[model samples]
Target: MIRKLEGRTWKFGDNINTDLMIPSFALAEPEEKQPKYCFSANRPGWVDLVKPGDILVAGNNFGTGSSRPGAKVLKSLGIICLLAESINGLFLRNCVNYGLPALPCPGVFSSFNEGDIASVQLEEGKVVNLNSGRVLATTALPNMLLEILAAGGIVPLLEGKGLLDKAR
Candidate 1:
């Protein structure tokens, strides 16, 4: 898996649910077009400002809502990884399934301001603020999850092992 990620941070508050990331209306749009609508309701014009390799830092209960493929949209929008004070369990799985690394660091919300550079080491469960030289410990992902991420998600992992039919 990708062991490390360093990127500019995008700070968000608590309860950043699936609806905010990918509105119900956006889901009906083409997959490639859906990302443009991310955070459109709450952070108008924010999606346009996001750059590839950016990291999202959020407060508690991040991604707490319906299973609407929000994680896929975030990855498509170029967010390489997510650091949050807390992440909803279902959403966390979705993130992994979509090949987006997400970690929960208890104090992550206050660690950086928007635009600060942050570095994350997934397996090590470490987060560092490159701008401030502050380090935070995160909940490490499991080895199996890391393997799935390395293969670009569970489907690919299974396919590689010949456990899934490619035709399907």
Candidate 2:
């Protein structure tokens, strides 16, 4: 994973949960077909608007529901990373596990609007709004977690070390 990421923003509000991201009904679909149903419950046509390398900027309690592999679906939708006022613990872990860089950035939600550009420096824990020239500090991920993300999540890291059977 690149330590620095820059992309267009897609703003969402507080308490945006896992169900809103990938509804239970969509779970039955094949993985490749699942991205189309993302945000179907609320933002009905949101999936169609997302472009590859877009960044999701959301308000507090982002990803506040079940452990439903929501990060994977977001990544599939071409979201490069997530920047939120706060992120749920389990969801943060899931993002790392799925190779998505999610930062808990205080004041981020107010700094950028939809379609604004955001630049994130992961290692430095800094978020800058390119459009408005605003900058916010984020809670940085530890180096160990960064390594996991860089290696494309824990499973791949272990596989590369021959610690687990790759065929599985």
Candidate 3:
């Protein structure tokens, strides 16, 4: 379901853990307000500057930390999608559960400079080089999570299907 997310690209090297995504201390705050304070502990000003549909590309190991179930920060940060060389399996699962598409497409970091336009196809596992119009690298997104993503987050779809009757 992923395609071209048109916006500025923020580039990072590697080992971008959850601490750099959203600090643990901020987890106490409500989810909607988290984005305004995202990564403020490490990068300070980058999150506030992020515009909707902007893509984040990192070399490897993006979002490796305690599984904090909040994509609200990432969502509010206006990140359309994340392309990384690699990602923590737990983060991958937790993120998508909250409606975040954490994809893996290695080599894009090497090919693209900051601000280069790119496109990600979840079905193909290929990130197209919009600048050069070439394919990047193939990767995998877990099958179960893909299903959840297709449903536009787990709870909403469940509620729509009348599968969340437990709350009532």
Candidate 4:
């Protein structure tokens, strides 16, 4: 898995739905073409501005809407990970399946700001504010999920273990 993640933070608030991440209008396009629409509705020009490996920190209930395409879009946009106070279960599953690390850090949203340098140690559940030297604790990622991420997603994970062929 991505044990250590270091990047500039892109802060967001609570209840940021999938609609805001990847609007419905963008879903019909191909995956390679979807990144351009990520956060276009909520944060105009976000796709053009966000850099690869940038960390997204948010408040409670991040990714609350019923849309899976947003996760794919965010992954395509090169979002390294998501640190939120709480994340919707379905969205979190989507993130994991897409090889995107999503962690629950209680104080992350308030402790950091947009453009703040941040780093996360997944196994240790440590979140650090590289800009101000602040530290926060997060829920440790489960080993199974870590394995999935390490293999680059669920499909790859299954393929590595020869499970896909057997299932087929």
Clashing pairs in 2: none
Listed per model in order, the count of residue pairs whose N, CA or C atoms clash below 3 Å is 0, 0, 0, 0
Candidate 3 lDDT, 1-168, residue by residue in tens: 544445567887887777666677777777676677677766788876778888888888777776765355677677877788887787777668777777877677887788887777776676776787777768657777777877777888687788887757
Q: Model 4, 11-83: lDDT tens per residue?
A: 8888999988767777787767767877776788878888898989999999999856567777778899899
Model 4, residue pairs in steric clash: none
Using TM-score, give the best candidate's number: 2
Query: TM-scores, in order shown?
Result: 0.95, 0.95, 0.86, 0.92
Worst ten-residue run, lDDT, model 3?
Answer: 1-10
Write down the TM-score for model 2.
0.95
Q: Weakest 10 consecutive residues, lDDT, candidate 4? A: 67-76
Q: Note the residue pairs that clash in candidate 1.
A: none
lDDT (Cα, 0-100) at 34 in candidate 2: 78
Where model 4 places Cα greater than 4 Å from the true spot, the runs are 165-168
Note the Cα lDDT for every prediction shown.
0.90, 0.91, 0.73, 0.85
lDDT of 1 at 22: 83
Error of 3 at 69 (Å): 3.1
